[model samples]
Target: MTKLYASLALGLLAAACGGGGGSAPIATENASAPAPVAAAPAAAPPADSTIDCPMFPASAIFNTRIDDTARFPVHADNAAWQELVGRATPFTANWGTSSNPSDLQDYWGMPFNVVDAAATQWPLVSFDYAASGLVFEASYPAQSDCASSADGSGVVRGCTQVPASQRRFPFPSGTTLAEGGDCGGPSGCGDRHVLVVDKAACRLWEAFYAHRIAGQWYAVATASWDLRSNAMRPDGWGAADAAGLPITPLLAKANEAASGEIRHALRVTFRDAALSLQHVWPARFAAGSDNPGAIPFGSLLRLRADFAIPDAWSPQAKAVARAAQRYGLYVADNGADLHVQGAPDSAWDPAVWQQLRSITMADMEFVDTGAITRDARFAKDSLQAGW
Candidate 1:
């Protein structure tokens, strides 16, 4: 399958970012950038969609424990990136605990759906950016879900390009796109990320700028993966998430917190003005600022080991704080500085999560991931994050 390649200048991609609570900033700096070349994540294990199912195998990067500061010391660039991100930028928990999407205060957290692998699938799509080079030619799920039209045309947008990828995802019928409620119910505008998982098959399908137009689904960019494997997306390929990373695995889930531990890293974003042109290993692309001395994708920021979890905090908050001290958070995308991503669930208590906002960038340090033997070895094209 020879895939049609998109240009580095994907002008039509996410003009608006659902993740950022605003318009998606185009990477004008990457217009002249070359595409990435890398290995796809491969190998796998038996899978299931059950609640107790693990997000990924133990060896997967998300599950790798990085709190051993003795072995994984702070990166040399840690101080610089921290200073650049600003010490005063407070940590903002960007998810809702309420189940009612309409009850969201801000543009609520990103949403995901789980379904059986055998569910009906559709390849209905069309790329908006000049990202033909990034298209993987895989099929995606589209169950004829429709966003009510503003124009009342009663015409469904047929596929000029059929785009759901090789793996299938299906949001339960009527699942709202991320920020869907805040933007304008289902017809709203925002990053509109749609993440669907096949629990039984251990597969995930994600799309950016997703919408159901005229009784059909559509997106500018999309990516899919087999959760049970460690191989990455083919080097240089674009994914729905800005960093070319999976969105859900890194999310701060209430259920995980209830279990008393978050084994994997959490997802975070900083302002694009401070993003680096370069991305690290595990991050297939750079989706932030072109500014020099800017932060880069795949950067790790750990809560200082000495930072104490206040006794007054909720158990969920304590669990997240402990995870930050241990597994830490990854600079997964370009968004507001210090904003941590999570799923919207009623289980998330607003009171406790609010307390997490006090831990600012001043309390964190970056991990020099190149120090790790397993992480450093997964190089893509000529790009490598390890020292």
Candidate 2:
């Protein structure tokens, strides 16, 4: 008979306290009763960087370990078990009355225990968020006590027996699997086993404790849950998890920000590296603009300078200008083209200039040649304030 594990029965719990506070109202004195009183303006919403979003406590982050020895039964009618079977089956195949034996054997090897079993109901066991690193302990009670038998009509039958053991397999370690690899590969294999319980021809199970690492809300560390017994096989598991996996909004936002920052940093670093190499060649400067293969360091420098200037041009402009002067060579043309001396046009071209414009405009209101030549101190402060 097919079985489901208790670990699959646990529900994902994501709780945060306190609704957003409303803006305070402005206060004014009564005209006739008292002296005039100035009203204070409402505070602006906090910047995305400064906002203190609630985070799951470290304790809650690693919950679900308690069910280490817990046992659970499986029944045909269990919702979780049914979900498991549905996921296990290939859409192209006709999943008839009997399940594949290899699949069943794989399920039995999972790291969970079977607690109880009956025809009408199945109670799966699992840990809370605090005990496990979001891994569920599952078991099938019917299979624990059932003995296989054959009926006279060429059909198979089984009688349920009581379970002798209620021990749980060890939890899988995160390091066991490297990112982007099969579970059976050198990096993906883990010492932990998973248990499943099936009853009423359905899989009833729960998963407990899922965690979001600090500074990485979207990047979650979850226990592996595979309906297919041979989840390590390339054919058993897909390239990525299905749509059912839960995702939090905070995680999504953080990921978006991180991606942007990475792209920005990469562009900046590439430009810096190219400039360092070009500064050593003096002959390349005299053979400017006409030579397509020649470097255009001056134009490149000017473009970077333009990108550093701020739209508001406050006291910060002087510092930004200094940074630009240090790294960039200016052509003095009406800010048209940038030409790095030693590096060929292929290294820094119009496309590069466009990219600089886009990144600077999006991140900062304005950028001038002076600002780009200045030291990094002014640029750092401007960026921190969201420019």
TM-score of each: 0.74, 0.14
Q: Whole-model lDDT for model 1 versus the true structure?
A: 0.61
Candidate 2 overall lDDT versus native: 0.20
Error of 1 at 20 (Å): 36
Steric collisions counted per model: 33, 80
lDDT of each: 0.61, 0.20
Top model by TM-score, which number? 1
In Å, residue 79's CA in model 1 sits off its true spot by: 1.5
What tens digits encode model 2's per-residue C-alpha lDDT throughout 1-387?
001121112211100112245642211111123211222122222112322221111111111011111111111223332232232221110011111222322221112222222322222122222234433323322111111211111111111122222212122222211111133321233322222222222121212221222211111112222111111111111101111111121111222222222111100111221121121111011111122322222222212223444443322222222223322222211111221111011111222232223332112111122222243422211111111
lDDT of model 1, residue 4: 13
Candidate 1, 250-367: lDDT as tens digits: 8887777766677777999877777775677677666543677677777888899988889988878888888888888888777788988887877776775678988989899988
RMSD value for candidate 2: 28.8
